[model samples]
Target chain A: MTAAALPRTTVDRRPPLGGFSLTYLALEIRRVLRNRRSLFFILIMPAVFFLLFGLPQKGQNIDQANSAAAIAYIMISLAVYGAMTASTATGGAVAVERAQGWSRQLRLTPLRPPAYVATKVLSALSLSLLSVLVEFVVGSIGGVRMPAHVWLLAGLGAWLGSLVFAALGLFVGYLAPAENVMQFMGPILALLALFGGLFVPLEVLPHVMRTIAKFTPVYGVGSIARSPLTHDFSWVAVLNVVGWTAFFGLGAALLFRRDTARV
Target chain B: MRTDTLAASETTGTRTPAVLLRGLTKKFGAVTAVNQLDLRIEPGEVVAFLGPNGAGKTTTIDMMLGLARPTQGSVEVYGLAPTEAINQGRIAAVMQTGGLLKDVSVAEIVRMTASFFANTRPVDEVLERAGIADIADRRVAKCSGGQQQRLRFALALLPDPDLMVLDEPTTGMDVEGRRDFWNAIRTDAQAGRTVLFATHYLEEADAYADRIVLIRKGQVVADGTASEVKALAAGRQVRATLPGADEVRLAALPGVDRAEVRGETVLLHTNDSDGVARYLLTQTTARDLEITSRNLEDAFLALTSGEDTDLEGVSR
Candidate 1:
């Protein structure tokens, strides 16, 4: 029999970018949002850290004008930490998906690899935005006395900078075994945060550690987020973020291709 | 561009074969999984790929689905590359297991799959057709093996594909579940969809497939209608107790396919059981003669074990 009789439900195949649909993104985000336990920790921990470390000081001998500027600086650092955790956590769920054969199932579909990667990045970024917003709100309630524009710019900078971590998460998600990925990720991210000066001021760190902090992936994001309030912008920070983004993004793309090819 | 390719496939007003593989080979290190396999399946034909475990059925199916590249040769679906056919939504597959996410509801995953295609059947309609409508709200992890297989079926149907490739679609299902799943598949096949399913169950191939292709060592050993294939391996067995029966002499006898002499008991596989039995009873000191027809399972073993007569001409 000829295929002419088959009900031809054909449509123009979308281009790679066109394959990335809002419907898919919304569904993925909805699934990610269902893990409320992770969301609770990601959102609450930064605020709690801000209350403990940045809340106590009234008039400290810091480089900034007043305790309020120092508090805003600390709040942005913690927000960067929160955003990193949220985005990486979101992106790292790929390890479980891969382990479950969902990635292979997706390879059978019309969805192109580029579209899949795009959806993943956007989904992770969306969660990062949420984490940044939560920190900003907590900072607001805790009497962070920055100009409104600084709060907006700093929050946007932090959320956008977390793209580097999103790429890192995908790379690790594709590389690490699914069962112990999170266990390795938690300590690794905490160390990056500590060394990158998201927890303590870089000026207070020992000379050697301060030098090492500038080279960490978190340093560029933290520096950019705080630059709005402290006027500490530098081309080095931009180069660091771009360089790591390319490194991790290329690694993720390669690993994803390898993973799909074998399965 | 699209119509041009479609028209090209309609040579002499006959469409291209639904699936065609030529000299397809796949190797993993020192192991050869599929060895120069060639097959051509016409549209609307429900063909069962029959083989035992480790017979390279899954490897062939994987190459056909373009999930793995062939080490050599080509795979075409409706005259297009397998991956191209998939991109056009002409083909979809229900893999054996582990395709569904455990935490997602059945209906939700179905909708998500529907979003992957440019044009698709309604998600609810596909779910209903696959017979999983009642359990649409159930989480996949809570569903039984049969329910999850049905869910995979629902996902495959979303693209409204013209060809469905299933790899052991009913592997873990109960007998009744197998019956229901095949019933659904039969209905879909009756709608003029070309289907290629890999199964190790002889009864499943006999009962469901219009044609069966039996494979052994990654090569087609038998390809014919169920009855024809059965006829190829069709015969009777004759057994008799005799002192020092010569297996070579009995195997050379007229109509005997294979003969085995074990101590005093001699077993002979032959089409003319009466002739073999008579000779053993009358011409020798044989006693306690017995004859039995070969069942499909026996036929399966004979065909797959390379013990059957040369069938290269039978399938052609």
Candidate 2:
């Protein structure tokens, strides 16, 4: 009965959008990084790859291609790997939330849907950066060199790669069946990376594989990422990455809206 | 089952409640989950929504929280829409699934969830209230089911919401854990916060709820307190231990609805237990006679028939 006398806590409806994105980003980072498995997958795997692959690519069959090409492609491949893994994890996380009714929980709370989505985007983007940096340092320590401006291409490639792959993951997270999320992602991403010129140069792949690689998202991301590695700019590769990002970005959002409509 | 007995002042004459609903409905594909649901939850009262599986409890909670757009109705929490109410952090929920991220310490999830609100409760105070102080540093994935449930309770409490909603919150708990969970619920209710509880556990509602609303086939079937519901159970049962030669005699009771003989004992069922008991004692050598009043389950069964069709189909 004394509850009537207790000061009530009213919800603040008009909070400015200040740092809301940061709050979400911070939360996602904390949650994802806290997972030992996620940490290994996100941080350690890329660094290991950089040490393993970044250093050895130069020792492998030598190419007249710019040392920047090798370093850039390594960065691009690592970035794609990072984005793909993060998206897969994030998509799986979203699927789990859907199954467990967590989204419904947020829907009932004061957290906006856009805020939630924005947080996922920022987290994946950041993780991609972290993974890229770790790989970059490993490659540099192993004696790979890039001019300062050449570094910008690596950054752009990594960022665009994150957006494109992260958007694909967002779309899949909403659209995929709850039970099959884990089983489908690894093979699909591996195949894309293998054919789209992440593992082997597109020029070295069989003609059929090269044809199939053109439409895959990896081609877009890999082309831009590999630009510094090769002296030549691959606008088509950049366009492919941008196109896939936009395609999957819009598609995933639409699926999410459709999926949540049932809630 | 009739809700007319609720004092008009308590619901009708009262001001706008903390949570209000007018014919909310949610649908998936062709299947409609919630039907027409008109409810009012005032601050400081605990209201239990009782229903069986697939009765749309989750869907209704979703509409109130603004997770799902009502196909037909509107939900107002803290005088605003569900999503709007959440944005203000005026509302909180203990969802069916624990939203705490696996691999992180429980303390971290609490801190992040608390940051979402402007006037959050202190971290330790909230943690202690949820009985999760000892496990604050443990990774969330390592916690026991009871611990996870308690951790979620802590997260929900961090915001110190005006309107708190729970969806099947005790699904994976043991007896002692359930008691601890109810303790948290009672604490919130005692604080004068409005609580909307959706549970299948009859005892939880029977023991704690100020009012109970029963939904069957997506429609509100009965709305009242436990006593009010039990009062509607008009049927009664009679049992007697008659010494030998009882089968034929018991069948001849004056107002018996059903009669069955098992060895030396005869059992009779009648709406008029007093009349039947009197006859059994006087007309025959029936010893060890016993009579008990009808329980809520009797009333519940009488109220809801199996295979009942859908209820209100309003969209949010």
Candidate 3:
């Protein structure tokens, strides 16, 4: 065919930035929920942990001088853990999408890059919220005892603290290979949980370990989440969580910029 | 079904070209993928970008679609920037491979992509158009290569784009699949939408494209209608039984480009085979005469293999 045979076409302009359509969010949420393996890792496993550790025992301390009831403390910790797992898991999914060339596909569309990232984060937060809810339910069924105020504070703190992990997930998704993203994230989350006093109370740990735990990002999230249960708010923990959130958020943004600059 | 909408837009009577590249160049470190390419494609023209491996076809297409930033020069689609044109739903592309979520069902993928566009065809209609409605419920990972290609086509159709760019869209498909894919594209093209495709398939360029643009080593070597480009490299062969033929005299004939004596047969290569055949018939006792025109593959090799010829002046 020659160029002379066809009539020329003219440009027709349309509006850009169709302001956060609910359909995009709904579709993303559906995709995340459909992944059963992700659901298990982010929600069910944390619920199981709450059930195992929060059950009231015959001789166990129900309440201590500084801390709230043992069931309530364990419930908050498990819920925070679930939130972190869910957020990071979503980041890992982002890495897999990049590997699959889905980012390239997205670049060709009307959807902007920032909008894509926002959708992923929103869906991740939704899943993390579900994980936290499931853990609370399991804790309730296991005879957790706490005032209504304590329950609300702890739940809100844990859910909000997960933003740090969501940022971390985006960082690792851009940094790590797709197939090994979970492998890279799993041990880090577990170690963070151990050191941050989600698995074992900081008071019971040796003096040196407790000091190091205060420096970990999870330590801030753990301390803040458990403040309602422990009736003690550590300004140091708040500072730590805020600091790490900024660090990870900046790192993820930089990495995403670099990745998109290529291919 | 939405031809009326397309016709209404066309009658707006604006005269912007579908695509225009002026001195477009892209360099990756020391390697240049495309160099000083200038082209203009009018609307509703089905143009084939023909090239060999590493011939800069992909790079040129990448620049055209705004996937890569050019080191020098500019690209405009519908007189708008490439990215702006794409965001406004004026352009869409079907990539060669790996632009899909493997775990999702076909319908889910289509709907997901459709969510990004402000205006879209009905998902079921796109599915039927691409001929993948039967596999709408199946996971993309489970679909065959051809089925996946069709799914990509469905995604491209979501915005009812004015220009569709397909990069090696039929690379992995079998013969029947290639035919079906082109048939779908043809139906869309018949609606007066502009289409640009890059492929190494000679027959595809000859059969599907109204114009052929051949690029080699980061520069366009030839650009014209299929027959015109073919004529640039077209050499015909005339074989006749002329015992004791004077190979020197034959080579020096009016239209003959080369002459060879093969046993009892005298073979003459010429740009004008009919003239040479007439000479052999009327002026000589040439028996068992035959003439054959060179195919597009031969034209391609001839145009691409030589030391960089400045055919940019010849291409219009």
Candidate 4:
């Protein structure tokens, strides 16, 4: 290690997009994709639930719609659940990265903090999309027959609505210890799914449970997703998704700044 | 844009110091981790920050790398804020530990780090230079501590930074690993890139650093070349064979800083070895008297130990 030339490479200062790069996002995605256990939970678990619950309801039709409508509703609910789980897991993984000091390592690089956050969101969104598509494919195989536009709109709604969970995941990741983050999130998500009417329809439930479900973040997502098929579009669902996104996004940003600002 | 700033400054022919910290203070609740510390490093100097555990070495390094912010004062890297300097790829760091991802292969992490910098050395070259090319395929979780450290070094090298700040860079390495790592760092330092490394190892500071900054209790107690720091804690030890020697009385004697009875022989640490030698030989039936100048270890203890906690006129 002697007589080596100085490292005098020309500086390429491209700060547009705040040092964001697809190469890094690809690597981040690749790491999660390689985790077979997580993939099972994010992609396979929802499909399993859909098969378990939706198959029994395959021959039934409610409100005089097609028999496939009941199965499609279950598929959409599972899709929302799967997409949220995928994104939240990806976002919540930040706690582990923080615990390992990888976050500190990244701060030393040219990658800005905003770029890191953006990469994480993109990475989570990618996995969320995959989770949603996996359910859709399974739904199609299981005789879920919706019009082409409903499939696209419902899939798009489920995938896009998952941005709220992505932010929630990041917030929880930064808030909770790495070991306890998923443990805390798992039960909370299940409860949210139940209260949001993703598990059982609000119609069958008592009046009080139905009233309280509307306030949960998951209810808004479920309404937006089911609106395309049910034709029951409401501005309240949009408010719920947008409001929770801002709330969790703000919380995550504050926690992130605090985490990086101290030892 | 940062390159343009650098090129402009170069044309003016006044080289900016690689790092400049002025009255830097960091407080975590009631504990003041770094207390108004000031340091300046010019380009090409390999300086060592020597301190014991909990002596604010990590905190100071954290502030310099923009991983933590200072509560008071300022840190400038090449005349820019720490984050700005880092964003410009003018500075990089090889932190003590836990920086590499466990599931990722060594090569993959290196490639990922290289992507963060718009201008970086080739990934393979950095891997080879850090001497981790052979283990590049191994997952970080499977790699040994030394291998992980080398991988961290490789990531730092990706940007080809002008200033490298390392916090205990050779912590988990073996003897030979430490030697090889320092050899690589020395080669880099010789090429006019400034390096500041924090370490608790006295020998690392003695052997590698052009200057040593000895810190204790969140303040610098001694700062100079290896020999200069040794000279700062100037003293000598006088040894004599005395049966049933009273260590307390000997320590109370004029010019005797400390005295210890080591079985048959009594060792007296003192500034005035002549006085200690005269007292031991004449006042007692002592024989086989010998005196020696203090080494760096003795100097380290003399300056760093004790509760004086005075912070004035100590630094060079």
- Going through the candidates in the order shown, the clash numbers are 0, 23, 3, 0
Angstrom error of the Cα, residue A218, model 1: value is 0.7
Clashing pairs in 3: A1-B210, A1-B211, A2-B210
Candidate 4 overall lDDT versus native: 0.83
lDDT of 2 by residue, B1-316 (tens): 2446343235445556678788877778898788787776666667788888888887888778776678898889867877677777677888777565665688877776665565578889888999999989998879988889888888888767777788878887899989988897887678787787898887887887887777766667667766555443334678888867456566666656468888887778665678888887887788898986677666565555433431221010
Model 3 misplaced regions, further than 4 Å: A1-19, A56-59, A62-64, B1-15, B240-255, B261-265, B275-289, B309-316
Candidate 3 lDDT over residue span A37-70, tens digit each? 7788887888887766667442355355753467
User: Residue B272 in model 1: shift from native, Å?
Assistant: 7.6
Quote model 3's TM-score: 0.90
lDDT of 3 by residue, B128-161 (tens): 9999999999999999999999999999988788
TM-score of the first chain alone, every candidate: 0.89, 0.86, 0.90, 0.91
Which portions of model 2 miss their true places by more than 4 Å? A1-10, A13-15, A18-23, A36-43, A46-93, A179-183, B7-12, B23-35, B71-74, B235-292, B306-316
Tens digits of lDDT, candidate 1, A98-187: 888898898788888778888889998998899899888888888787788898899988999999999999999899758457677989
Q: Pick by TM-score: which candidate is best? A: 3
* Full-model lDDT for every candidate: 0.83, 0.71, 0.83, 0.83
Going through the candidates in order, the fraction of native interface contacts each one reproduces equals 0.49, 0.43, 0.45, 0.58
What docking tier does model 3 reach? acceptable
